[model samples]
Target: MLRFFRVIAPAVLLAVTLAAVFWGLAIGGAADERTLLDPGDIVRYGLPLSRTLVNVSIAGLIGSVVMAVWALATDRDEYRIAMDLAAASAAVLTVASAATIIFTYIDVSNLAFSPDASFGAGLAQFVTEIELGQLWLWELLLGASVTVLAFAIRGRRSTLIVLIGALLTTLPLAQQGHAAGASGHSQAVNSLLVHLVGAAVWLGGLVTLVFLAKAVSRDRLALLVSRYSTLALLAFIGVAASGIVSAWLRIGSFEDLFGTGYGQLVVIKALALIVLGAFGAVQRQLLIPRIATGERGGWIFAWLVTAELAVMGIASGIAGALGRTATPVPQESAQDLVGSTPAEFLTGDPLPPELTFSSYFTEWKFDLAWGLVCFFGIAFYLAGVIRLARRGDRWHVGRTIAWLIGMLMLFYTSNGPFNAYEQYLFSVHMLGHMMYMMLIPLILVLGAPITLALRATAKRTDGSWGGREWIMWMVQTPWSKFITHPVIAAVIFVGGLWVFYFTPIFRWAMSEHLGHQWMIIHFLISGYLFSLTMIGIDPIPKRYPHPFRLVILFATMASHAFFGVTVMTGDALLLADWFGAMGRDWGADPLADQKTGGGITWGIGELPTLALALVVAVQWARSDTKEQKRKDRAADRSGEAELKAYNEMLAKQAERDAKVGPRR
Candidate 1:
């Protein structure tokens, strides 16, 4: 029966996605003349009045809710009962709205053909016309049911994630033609929905698969994992291919691909996916088998998965560009940058419109180079301290510092600087963002508490009382509170991305020697928040109970997904081209480019976030198991030692001052 599911599950999933894709294309390509309204009538008004939000209500809202509730029931295990309840509730709320939401879509889709009516009305009519009937209601039930069953065999989050992906197929029925991104409405709805689903399935499933595999046989785990991995790979390929093809249509030509700011950004995103795919291949071939071999292998596999998951975050940022507009060229725009001196570039004035960090350092501005060097030198200094702490009480501070210095120099001499340059110039910004937000933080968590610091500091009792008290207070008071609140960290994670991309200050971050510095900041801020959110090896701030944390995580993801969709749907330029005449020299339309960027951001961006959220929950739950074992061992040791010492002390007291030496 399990084998039957193993084979049938993926096949069924692929068929649904493929059928939905084709159905979308047929009507989308305009082969079917029975649209909500005639193009001829709409063209008279010169507007694509077809865009609507109802599609999302069907695919994301309805489908997601159903999947969530069903997952709750299936995931009702000893470890996650509360999680099951919350998810089931969410599913009830989201999926139960089907009757109402589906009616809204059908009403809009069947509206009469008329260009004279207001554009808003046309949009409404089109959305209402999409038939939301028994088929979808039943389909939603089946998808959620399958998801529940899948989670039963697998786990909770993994089951609903399967539905997340499966739910997206319903978009076509909402009158969103196959080439979804072509129409802004389709793009808006699917932008975050598709990727969110895929990421949840891939990243979350891998976490489950890898850990479960650890307790079982290599061949069994391998075969089971491989089945899922194949699904993930296919999903990734589907998203990438669909994205590229959609981009080609939206962008029009090669000129639009690189000749414009938005186009170049998309190209960079494509390249990043290629690189991630390359690394994924290496991980699959070299690492999974190694991990399946046993304990050490499992650790290595954990790292490999960490690295892969980390890259997905970076990929998400680049993909966010799909919702942005191409930089526009205005009348009377200057062709060249207005920089007169070195200081001009530093001030973000007279800089080229297309200026990037890597381009600035070469022939553009040599004066700022040394400043970047000094900055990295400082980061190395900090890293040295952390590395020293990594060894706990086992190593000397001086040796650790020296080791870090050597690593820093090696980092500079090898491929580090080049990669840093790329990051500053393009999607590298997002990559570094991931390192700060996810990878390095995870590394720090695994490094554990500063055992050496605690020990050495314990010997410093002769030092000033104020300093010691300060350190004590730092640990006992606000320090943990500042980082541990899940809401606080979630805000930072989502907000930092918003702030960097939405301001003129972002340009400053992109240029000058400060570009790398800003990247470092991004990495640190994100890393700090991410580590706090996940199961770090070190002590965390006040953690919510597992049930609460899982709920919050799910809500956090939903909010951000909606945020991306909002960006995709709106017709606005995020950054506003604060570069004066330089902004106008780039002929493309900023609003359209931003919409494309936002669409991609909304649709695909949540994938990594959702994946990370689920992984964190699973890892935290698993850690609870390990922690119980650790505590049991420590308690046993302490008990034995106390008994031995109590007997010895009793003998001494009996011979001397007696009175029951230390209470046993």
Candidate 2:
């Protein structure tokens, strides 16, 4: 049974996926003959089929690397087999991406195969000049790179690098297809990327586990399965959440779920997810424990896994068809821009209502990527606290409150009116930047999350990387040492502001979604590192003395205040094309608004700076008190021996001075 399952399970997955693809194509009319520029039924049907291969291959490629890094030991057969699977999957991804690129061009161009120069030139132009074509070409290149790296890389750090490359192959997919449209474009792309990666890891990890069934000992297999269950749980959460966001963006209304073909396909996919989730619960609750305890044999586990993979195949195929099906809500937002203002035309969204005090709290435009980060940040921190508490360990309540407040601030900064109005208001954007780079990090560092995590998590003995192991590795690395230094951290904190605002980076952050996200991350890290160096309770290679910390703080504060003043006093507008051309009829004028932003930068920043200074002063005072207490305790222990020695030295010094006076 194990041998049969090992050989035929993957084949089963492939056959079911293809069959489901054709079935979905039939239901959605994606394979119907086009009235104009029909590329023939072969191209119409072949495109979705090839996409299924790409998706499955991606699952295999990414999943194997995740398993190898998180669960399987490097010296074991399980780890070796997982890497081999990654290599094979990456090779498949390369060919499938190539096929997808060709099929996509044929579908788009409606041109028949030919050997003529014009045809070759058109094909080359599509791949080189067009956005969709460029994306696919990049995917192909990334896949090919992963294929080579997966075979060559074996060390833990090297495998992680290869894994990152493997994941990069999926980014192009997120930016293309229906997700490329302007309306809710960022949300759609973010949600779809989240869904793709989550499903890939969850589905691919299980398939890899099935293959490992025959290679590893039963007990070892059970242990690996247990480790994988944690990944599956996290992946499930991400997939489920992102799927809802994706569906809402496309379906628009609950009624569409029952009415539209696209919505029906979503229903089918959702059902498959439910079934797969049930399979995960069974694996975690019933099968794994029983198998580990010798109550259930490994063969039963193999059959159950095969069934799970078949279900995953159905979901994967349906998802591909959903991409091809016409969405109930129009994916393209260009038509809505017909009579829009310059603001709408440029920002791709309507100008928000006039900024008000209440709007800061009431208005919201969710950022899915950062929303997920904040959610998981608080959830995991709370979970760690709970685990520690259950074990009769004490973590400060103040720390917990500080962490929650920081995460809440993070969520609000990304999703609240600050985000909604940032494109329109330079002041609001600058305010959000202040929170991201200073206030949020100040609160978060006080939480001492690294210290909490180190205290909370158990040390892993296996040759696999877990949360605790990875954290320790990050802290102790040479790069970490260099970055966390007071001087370097101060430089980054102070210098980054000038470089960002003065460079094209400011323009990119304003106009591009990915660039905006990167801006937040870069500033947040710079702030965190700076705060960590100054007042963080977390362990580090070194920290400056308290007086020196005061000096660094004062220097950074002066530079920050100078930057704000510089912006306020400058006559020229930054990103004149963007902020100047917004055509806002409400609020301050562009130049005036830019000045307001500078004022905000200068004004709102002082509170955190003062807080940092006070904390440093308090720590210094406590350090002195502790030193005096140590000396007093030593005097008590030694019965004032040091004090008597001091007096004896003074007496000898006096006698020597008298003898010298007599001589004079």
Candidate 3:
């Protein structure tokens, strides 16, 4: 089956892409008027819709390539590595060529017509130029990689060089059209582009490192990973520096930063990246050395990699949103996305901000309950973190911080942004999911709480506190078992999305004063459960079998994606606000909302799938380890007993000599 997929998937993807190309060209031809593309008119052509669809297709192709690579790696082939790289190169070529071709099709007159799209042809031109240009660099590397790989594998450079040359022709041979101008973009947009590229080089390289670690020499791999760690750290620092500067430059005032749509979304993006960078820093500073030493650092490396990957995914999401907002779309006011009453939508403002702290405080007790929960939760976590780190055990601090961040993201902030956007607004919802699903899971996974709990317990040699023991007992109880089961976790994750969306809960929550709070709860539960089930970085008391766990992850993700594509293709208005009720126009169209959600799911799903498969495969390979240990126990036990007796004999002899006199 894997073999079949490897061969056919890419072929299908390439076919779809070629079809889209011809379809686009035909669409271009059918328009009677000259559709010459100028950079300014790029925005006028309603090109984001076009660009987004293309994004969907391109992402699918990349996903196919990733799956193909995985299949190649795991297949029992001696030349697995060589085959995988060749497959990857081919995938990269297909995507890059197709992206560039769209630009070639555009000419000049198309620019003048866009309403607000004049800024850079609706940001499509901007993105197309960047991705298409970036492909050339990949082409070069693909060639170099093939050359080196062929030589290493086949003991010849000639075939490799020929492959490299063939890869070169994959570059844009068609007309090099004028790339979009960035002049109209706010400084934030300009800076974001630069940050994104830097981020891609850093995070994408890290991802490749994780995937290739098994094949590379351990010593060399350690050094290579260290280099990447350094690179990631630098990129993070750049993200922080550029992000803050860009924020200040783009936002006009506090209102713009907080009150306005662009600013608030940017704030969310910036903050998520900040948390992600901090997570990466821990990996670079702490884990790399320990891992290089080849000692068992327990689950630390796994947590670090998962956190980094999650961060990378969220960052990609932020980049997507940036493309949407770097320049405003005229006639598509903020009100439209928010689903303000038609009066408000047509007038160009968000739904009146009704659910404020004041409203929550009015019903003081319930509000107080939530307030206490978040406050104490954050405080307890942070305090424990500081205590553990100070005790020279970093795990406690790491896990606590991760849990706290995840809690805050899901239980508190997810909804504020959700409400702030109004309706099932696509961009805001994406941001919300990024927070709840991606960012929160990342932090929790990094914490590796189970391992931390064990270490913290071990360090206290005295075992003085029975109080801590009770808490530990409860955590390990059967009831706790039910909650943490992979199947249950998967159910929570897969079930939560639909329950929220399909039920009136989604509507009532959207309409009522406490709806934001409800949304937060939904996000937290769904996000945490999802993380716990699939990429599970936290300690597991008893885990499901490797095969079962893998199946669980795959199944849950499939569920999520099933809904996701359904959401995208769904013409039915799932949410009342999605239809833009009368005067209250949701800022973005329902179609756009559906489309954006699908894109997020489609783009982000592949990484998790691959990660899950690898982890599960590792688990499967180790299934007999427990039995082997049991069989060896008696012999090991006797050896330890003998060693213990020898140590005692030495201690006793030393004591006797000291008491009696040195010479005797």
Candidate 4:
């Protein structure tokens, strides 16, 4: 019965996916007279089919690799099976991505396929010169590369790297989906990326499990199922959240949920998700515990998993069609640009109201990615604290408060007026940078999250690496030690400011969303490392002496102040084209704003510097007190033997001097 179902699963996915594709094409008017008269049926039908193949193959590739790392001991037959699955899937992905490139070119360029020399040249030009072509080409190349790597690499660390590579391959596709000039463009892109990756992990992991069903030992099956179940839970949350965001962007209102073809497809997908979630809940809450206790639930678990996979196929099919379906609320509306200012055209939103003191607190521009990040960070940290408390472990309340405050500050800086105005005003950008690099990190370091994690997380008796193991491995690595060095961390923190603003990197970050995100990550990490070196209570490779740390701090402060002063006094504007050409209606003059930014660097930057110095000073005093108490304890333990020895030596010296004085 299990064998029959295994054979039937792939067939079901194929039949359902093809049926959904055709159904969606009909409903969404892909073959409408308008499109048929131009690109015709080949593009209308073939493009979405090829995209479906691309998505499924990519999922198989990523899911197999991730599962191999998270489970599948190296010596097990299932391990080899998982890697072979990854390799085979990568091969499929390579072919599908190549086909997707060709089909996408035909759809986008409205050019017929040809065999002439000019056709070859035009194809080359398309891949090299056009952004859409370049994206698919990159995906093809990444898929091909992973295909080779997956076959050759068998070590856990190497496989983990390949897993990351597979995830990165999805980014190009995500970036291409949203029009850059559309409102909520960043949010759409972010949500799509999360959606694609989450779906891949969830779908792909299930497929791999079914493939290895016979090879896995019955005893080990429960363990793999338990681990994969946790991953599925995370993936479920990610998919649900990102799906809602994507739907909101496309449908615009609840009324459109049933009113439009796109919305109807979204509703179908949502239903499939709800079904999958229920299956997942049953597996996690009921079957997994029974299986772990050596109960004969394997057959029931298998049937449930098979049903979940079938539902996932339906969702995947719907998603492929959704990619081609036209939405009633167009992402980029003509109405949006009817009376748009230059700022609106450039930023995809109208110029923000003029900067005011209260606006900093009141205004908001929520970033989906960072907002989720902050939310997760706070939730997880609090969970860790609660876990410790429930176990009768004492965790400092102060650390929890500091952690929450830091996350709140991070949320505000990334989503508040600072982010909204950063593009238009240089000074506001600096303010955001300062908070990201110095203030927030300093507070977070005080939270001692690492300490909490070590105490809170369970130790895995099994050889498989878990969160605790990975954290310890990372902290113990030579690279981590080098980065956490006081000198190295200080250099990165202080030097990044000059390197970023003075170079073309600043302009790149302002112009490109990915670069902007990288900039934030870099500053935040560097700041966290520097602060950790100075005042962190968590375990690290080494700690510097108080005097040397003070020296590093003072030197960093001086260099930071000098950079700010340079920015303030300089006549030339940094990123002259970006901030200068924003055409903002109300704000400080560009050059004056540049100076104000510089002043922020010099002036506002000092507050964090002073705070760090004060923290270091307090830590230094405490160290002295600790040493004095240690000596006092030693004296009490030894009965003041050292003092008694010194007094005896003084008496002998006096007696010898008295005898020598009579001879003199």
Quote the lDDT for 353 in model 4.
Answer: 89
State which candidate has the highest TM-score. 2
Per-residue error (Å), model 4, residue 45: 1.8
> Model 1 misses residue 423 by how many Å?
13
What stretches of model 4 exceed 4 Å from their correct place?
A: 1-6, 31-37, 292-296, 332-340, 645-664
Model 2 lDDT per residue over 1-664, tens place? 8878777788888888888888788787788887888888778888888888888999999999999888888887788899999999999999999988888888898888778988889989999999889989998999999999999998876788888997887788888845342667777888888888998899889889988988887788888899889999989999999999999988999999879888888999899999999999998988887665664567678788889889988999998888788888887654354676787667777788889888977899987778889999999999999999999999999999999999999999988898899889899999999999999999999999999999998888867778788898888999999999899999999999999999999998888767887899998999999999999999888877999999999999999999999999999999989999878888989999999999998988877987999999999999999999999999999999999999999999999999999889
TM agreement with the true structure for every prediction: 0.33, 0.96, 0.37, 0.95
Model 1, 526-574: lDDT tens per residue? 6556555554433444656667666766776676667667766775544
In model 1, which regions exceed 4 Å deviation? 1-459, 465-472, 495-523, 579-611, 627-664
lDDT of 3 by residue, 169-195 (tens): 322221011121111122233344335
Clash count (model 3, backbone only): 25
Give lDDT: candidate 2, residue 576.
Answer: 89
lDDT of 2: 0.88
Candidate 1 TM-score to native: 0.33
Predicted structure with the largest lDDT when compared to the true one: 2
Local accuracy by lDDT, each model: 0.44, 0.88, 0.49, 0.85
Worst 10 residues of 3 by lDDT: 174-183
Write the number of the candidate with greater TM-score, choosing between 2 and 4.
2
